[model samples]
Target chain A: MKALVWHGKEDIRCDTVTDPEIQDPRDAIIKVTSCAICGSDLHLFHNFIPGMLPGDIMGHETMGEVVEVGSGVNGKLKKGDRVVVPFTIICGECEQCKRGNFSVCETTNRKRHLADKVFGHTTAGLFGYTHLTGGYPGGQAEYLRVPFADATHIKVPAGIPDEQLLFLSDIFPTGWQAAAQCDIEPTDTVAIWGCGPVGQMAIRSAILLGANRVIAIDCLPERLSMAEAGGATTINFETESVVERLQELTDGRGPEKCIDCVGMEAHVMPSLPDTLLDRAKQMVMAESDRPHVLREMIYVCRPGGIISVPGVYSGLSDMLPMGAFMNKGLTMRTGQTHVNRWTDDLLRRIEEGEIDPSFVITHTVPLAQGPEMYQVFRDKRESCVKVVLKP
Target chain B: MFHFSNIVRTKGDPEIVKGGPSLKQPADQLARALGWFSIGLGVVELFAPRRVTETLGMEGRETMVRAFGVREIMSGIMSLSVDKNAGLWTRVGGDGLDAAALLSGLTSDNPKKGNIALALLMVGGIAVLDYRAAQDTKPRRPPRDARRKLYPNRSGFPKGIESVRTAARQIAAHAKTHLKTHAETNEVKQGDERRVP
Candidate 1:
């Protein structure tokens, strides 16, 4: 099987690897037809989230035809089922799963200890993020072993193409989940901080859920233009200060809900001493994540409103505006998106033609071109927002 | 939220799979968490001692921070490998030492005294969580039951010649059921929807 494997920092290669077999009774093997590169994968490629071993398979956004099933899978799933596997692997029976908090499932992360030490709690196993999130082989391959098959995958309708449904695996659900966290009132104003794939999805999701105004902020013209296309008021942070522009847009009340789509690697341009300090800390290994977006959110959100963070942030250790956070009476909610929780609904939305997630797929290439595409996406070289690999 | 059952059938309603960690369980989960936290913190300290020390504005004390990192790593490994109780308790004790060290930085003339104060408070909070987890879970005996439920318990398989026959029969039965179900699924899928190979 040929798959994308991580070799080292900024190094991903297309390598021939062993096809995955069912390792547990609840597992099923999928012959992958489409897989996409995620913004989070850039963290792995850049070694931001740590704990990467050579030759580890990478990629999680995937959809495929089920080729095999383990007996424990019972009768609900079978061979030849076309499905989109959520990145978050969950045991439908866990306490968290029962409560619909499927991302922190206790049973799947074999390396919970690693995650626990850093996060102070165990995260549910992710398909291909890091050892901290269960280093299961990912789906950018010829075949993938999906755990908890019945609970963790969404069976796509027959008429849908892989491109239309593939994102039900990660970004679509993530964007929807981010918006869901905002607890948006029908008339509320929502501000999103990134224009990447997740950010774009979030903009549309907010509209779908009835936010009166969705404000999109970013430095990239392409991304900002895309946000505008989605009926958002765009702010080019390079030319305008997010604080002033947002204040103008929201009549100085700040956005009722502020979502941080840019997680660990938040960069603020035009230079603040604070931003420089954050960079220095990351450079010196003092912090693992950048908190610029989070800090700004705390300041920009309405005093009693929510700051919904969907960013995959493990930013600079222990550096936050606790004073502002406590004084303003702001509520914060964030976690890895419980993909199963939102996939079914998002799938329906897609089926209804409410949104086309594939609009974000700027480039589609063979699996072998993944290494170059990683660089292209990271450097923002070619108006790229997302990349899909076909095997 | 969607009508998955009415619309399509998956492997099973895994929520009713008769196996999951109870919402009320604890112990091993806590101890392992403490152990890994220690390792993660230690790795950061070992590789970036200057970063830790400089954050405290105790620029010249990088070596001391590295030594502390070594202790954290050892304690973490102990919590992971040795007696869970002792390992957790050791972590709690290490917390005390860390508090004292941070207090020293606070009292010292490090220009970023505010940072040192915050660091001390953070360490103090972690200490409280570690102590509680340590107290809740006793050391030594593994939480084998919880683990067994999460994974299949393979211990009861027969060891005698009967084991071979029993295992073979299980395999044969699974294959037979698979073929029947698959044939049925294929038929339904062909008529009701698109079936992908």
Candidate 2:
């Protein structure tokens, strides 16, 4: 099987790998049909997130038909069942899973000790992520071995294109969660930072959830244009002041709901001194994440409002405005998406034609071209927004 | 490396059978090599400034040598980072300073003029490589002012934006009504309890 393997910083290779085998009764093997290069994958590509070793496969957004199923799957899943494998592997019997906190399912992570030390508790095992998250082989390959397959998969029916359903594995539900957690009110002005794929989806999700106005901030013209298409008032932070523009749009009260979609690697610019400082500290290994978006969101969000974060932040961040956060009596919510908690509703919405996630995909290529697409996506060349790799 | 990584894999997980071409370009490889070279050279200059100055016949300039070493180290770190282009450009500028300093030591009175000339030649060569790597490693992102293909029609809504907005409004209205009705029922229940008492 051919898979995209992580080498080091800025290095990925399409390598011929041994076929995955079912190690447990709950495991199932799927012939992957489609996968995607996620914005968070850039963190792994840049070697920013620790625990990823050389030869770890690189992807999470994946969907395919089940070629083999374990006996433990019972009748819930069988051969020929088409499913979108959610990034987080979950054992449905766990206490966290019972509470719909699937991303922190207690039984899934094989390397719980590492996560326990770093995060104070283990998170759900994620595909192709890192060793700290169980180091499972990812789905960016010809085939994937899904652990806890019966509970970890979102079964999709026929008649829908792979493009429409593939994002259900990650970004679609992730974006929806980002907006849903905001508890968006019809009169609320929701300001979202970053216009990447997740950001674009969040924009649409915010509008569908009935925010009075959805403001999207990014410097890229193409991304901003896409955000506008999704019914968001776009802000190009490169040319305009995000704080000032958001203030002007919200009548100086600041946006009631603020979303940070840019995490870890905030765009470094001379105009943003904090971003520059963060980058410097990041390069020196002093700070693990660039929290410019977090700082900006805290500073610009309305007093007593909510700041919802679906972005992936790896470790420690410096110089956060905890004073403002505490004084303003604001609420902050962040986590990996409890993918199963929202996928059913999102899938219904997709079937009802409320929104199509495929709109964000600007590039599609063969799995063999996955290596090149990573570069294109990372550089944001050719106005690239999202990349789907057909395996 | 693959074998070592395989050692960590569980029994059933796939291991690499054969490797393919890396995504890294030649220029990226060049930048990496240069980055390590810069760090190695910087460490020597930093820790052994007297040796560096003696080799260049500028014995009294150890402090300046150490300063250059710090600059080299910083540039090397940047070069090894995602912003390798900036690091390479910094190296290019550092090379200019290096050349000028070596030229200053090319005086007739200096016994190691020949050594200074050799160092200058090496700097000149490294400068060219740095400049090339810097240019090649520059991000391929389209110019900010370039004509962009805007997506005005991709609303992701198959039912059109207006219809979705209408549905959202109706949902909100229904929720409001539901809340009002529930509140009215609760008030009636309270009134009934007081009347019974």
Candidate 3:
């Protein structure tokens, strides 16, 4: 089958590859219907995440119809079932899975020792991520091999189009989890950084969870407008200081919860000795991540509040203000979204017509043009916020 | 909840899912072991600085020894929180710092010069392991044209002519029957199809 293969940083190609088949007794093969390019895929595109080899298939957000299933998944999944496979692969019976922390499932990492040496423990298997995860072929292809199908896939009704349900595989749950982590109260004020797909979802999620005010920050007019449509007050970080504008927006009291949707590869501005220095250091491997948004979150967040991060942070970055963190008694919470836990609840919300998640999709093209659309998304051309590919 | 009478087998080899990673490299395991070794030694030094200085026979340098312990603990934590390449390099840097500390002991006129020599030997041994780990995890730049296979004019189809999605629908119409049937079948359980908007 044809798949998008990663060649090098900034180089992706549409190529013919072997179709995926069920490998594990608990696995199933899905004929991919709709798959989207996630912001995290840009991390791999930039070569920030370690261990991405040539020929690695790249994608995560996907939903499809089950073409086949292994016997081990016997009463749970059947051939032809419409399902959205969570990016995090889990066994469903591990201690972490039992505790609803499926993102940290232990049994899936065959190379746990590699992560163990770095993260003090291994995380769950993720499709098409690097050797850091299981490196399973992603859904950016004609078909995908989904392991632990009984647990990892959430069956969506056939009537619900792939466009609406596909985000269930990643961002919808990711945004919901980030909002949930804030432990929001009805009158709480929430500030979100980066108006990307996840940030837009987070804005809707925060409102659904009853935040009185949601401030969305970004320089892009389109993204900011989308956030506004999602019921968030907008902050243009390019023209205004995020910290000062947020402070003014909240009447000198910073928002109760701050969310960092921008992760390790956050862009820094044209400033010297700060953003430029960080980019230089990041390029030369001085740090594994760019923590610009993290620093801003720490500096601008309300005292004694929650800074919920749906962002991905890998390796080590420099310059955390430990004194501010200690003095203000801030509580920080972040992790890969425990997608399985939120699937049932969020699907109900989607089914109920409380929101339509697919509104974020700005471009839809065939998989053959994925390499080009990636640049369009990366460069934010044609007002692209999200791109969905039909394979 | 879904079922079809016939399994539609597509073209090409069914990729076997290797559920997890391959075996851990020898150097990777050694790097982890060395990380633990640093934590253990650092703990001992932090809590028993006197004993550490006495063992190295640099008795008067208890404060400096404890500071080195703190550095060692930080290094161990760093080694445990990054990729193997970064972790191993951090270890190399730590080893250099350690060598400098031991050289200070070498000129101290201390009683256990042999013990300091032993410490240096241990550092030398671990440094070799750290070096090996770094080499093992180093980023290998691929050739510019690697992984760039383009099937021009072939749209991911078995026929190698039409676009992939157009061909998918021909098989997909057959597959959708199974899904619609399965959806109908599942609705008997939760009346879910009725609820699908």
Query: Per model, how many backbone clashes are there?
Result: 7, 0, 3
- Candidate 3: residue pairs that collide: A21-B15, A118-B80, B155-B164
State the TM-score, rounded to 2 decimals, of chain A in model 3: 0.98
Q: Categorize the docking of model 3.
A: incorrect
- Tens digit per residue, CA lDDT, model 3, B54-135: 8887788788778878867766654543334665687798899889988888865778888889999999998998888788
Worst 10 residues of 2 chain A by lDDT: A374-383
Cα displacement (angstroms), candidate 3, residue B116, comes to: 54
**Taking the tens digit of each residue's C-alpha lDDT, what string does model 1 give over B69-104?**
988887786566424566788889999989888887
Clashes of 2: 0
Report model 2's interface C-alpha RMSD after superposition on the true interface residues: 1.0
lDDT of each: 0.78, 0.93, 0.78
lDDT of 1 at B165: 34
DockQ of candidate 3 against the true complex: 0.03
Each prediction's DockQ against the real complex: 0.01, 0.81, 0.03
